[model samples]
Target chain A: NAGVTQTPKFRILKIGQSMTLQCAQDMNHNYMYWYRQDPGMGLKLIYYSVGAGITDKGEVPNGYNVSRSTTEDFPLRLELAAPSQTSVYFCASRGTGGADTQYFGPGTRLTVL
Target chain B: DQQVKQNSPSLSVQEGRISILNCDYTNSMFDYFLWYKKYPAEGPTFLISISSIKDKNEDGRFTVFLNKSAKHLSLHIVPSQPGDSAVYFCAGGKDTGRRALTFGSGTRLQVQP
Candidate 1:
């Protein structure tokens, strides 16, 4: 089964443009997270969802929004993209318990100019 | 401030040799630690994990060692192969209700044949 799937492997956005990164998992995991990885920096959490219909802000949630409409899907939306938003975005899912292993999707690389 | 830190930006090792990657955390409440390996253009994959209650965990050629008193953890790979070349990340989670993880800047390991 496709563990975790992300759409649009690559994208380019102009300043002030907006886009959404799509993520879906077939594992029926209850926890999903969006993270952005910048060069020479660690992965920073952007948003997360514990389950469908519940989403929460993460460490670096300033320019992003997220929605979890179904257990399989949690999408991250970038509003008013800036140069600082250019980074690789990853979607991860994990079981409902604490300290469970997280499975990540092939990331989407976004370049904002 | 970054709660987790990986001081080494990169490491080089000869094939069949041992490789050690280090990581440190500033938060004393972290109870769970994990290591992930990533190839270029791919998502980070789970490698191994250690709980605060334990000092070491091993899987095949990979071993994770946690020193809670020092707030440091390390990943060791024995008989390293060229295929082991990848970026390695260390992540830590607190025992609090949320179980959110904080990751360190990854260390790029290059195993040369």
Candidate 2:
């Protein structure tokens, strides 16, 4: 399986601009997550979805939005991107059941100026 | 508060030597713990995980030890090789609910030849 895949390995956006970070998984995972890692810092979850139609906010959900319309896809939207949003974003997924190991994609490196 | 912490920012070990990485957590509700390895410009990959029920889990050259009473966990790599160098992240999560993992700042390991 291709596992999880993300688009635009790198991108730079101007302040106030908006874009979507696309994520998809071939593993048919029931849960998907979005996380951002700053330099010298641990990853903080931005959002997560339990299924296609259910989504929830995470630790750092400000300036971002997400939707899971299918079992294989979860997309993250950054509206009015700010300089603070310049960081590496990772997408991950896990199969049904709690405590399942999450598989992560290669990640998208985003820079907001 | 930082629920999970990997205090050491970096560690180096000689080739074919053992490398030990440590993690401490503050949350007693965290019943599942995981370790992930990441290379530069890549996403973190799942390495190994241990549940509260089991104190240890082994996979090939990697072993994870859990000390639930002390809220501590560790990862041990035997015969560390150059290819084993990467940033290791410790994450903890609850076994129930939609609660996601809280990751610690990664520890960078360099296996020198």
| Chain B TM-score of candidate number 2 | 0.96
lDDT tens string, model 2, A57-110?
Answer: 999999999988899999999999999999999999987776798889999999
Candidate 1 on A3-99: residue-level lDDT in tens? Answer: 9999999999999999999999999998899999999999988898888998999889998999999999999999999999999999999886667
lDDT of 2 by residue, B10-81 (tens): 999999999999999998888789999999988999999998889999999999999988989999999899
- Which digits, one per residue and each the tens of the lDDT, describe model 1 over residues B1-113? 98999999999999999999999999887878999999999999999988889999999999999888898999999989999999999999765554567899999999999
Best-performing candidate as measured by lDDT: 2
Task: State each model's CA lDDT, in order.
Answer: 0.92, 0.94
TM-score of 1: 0.97
Return the interface RMSD of the candidates, in order shown, one decimal each: 1.4, 1.0
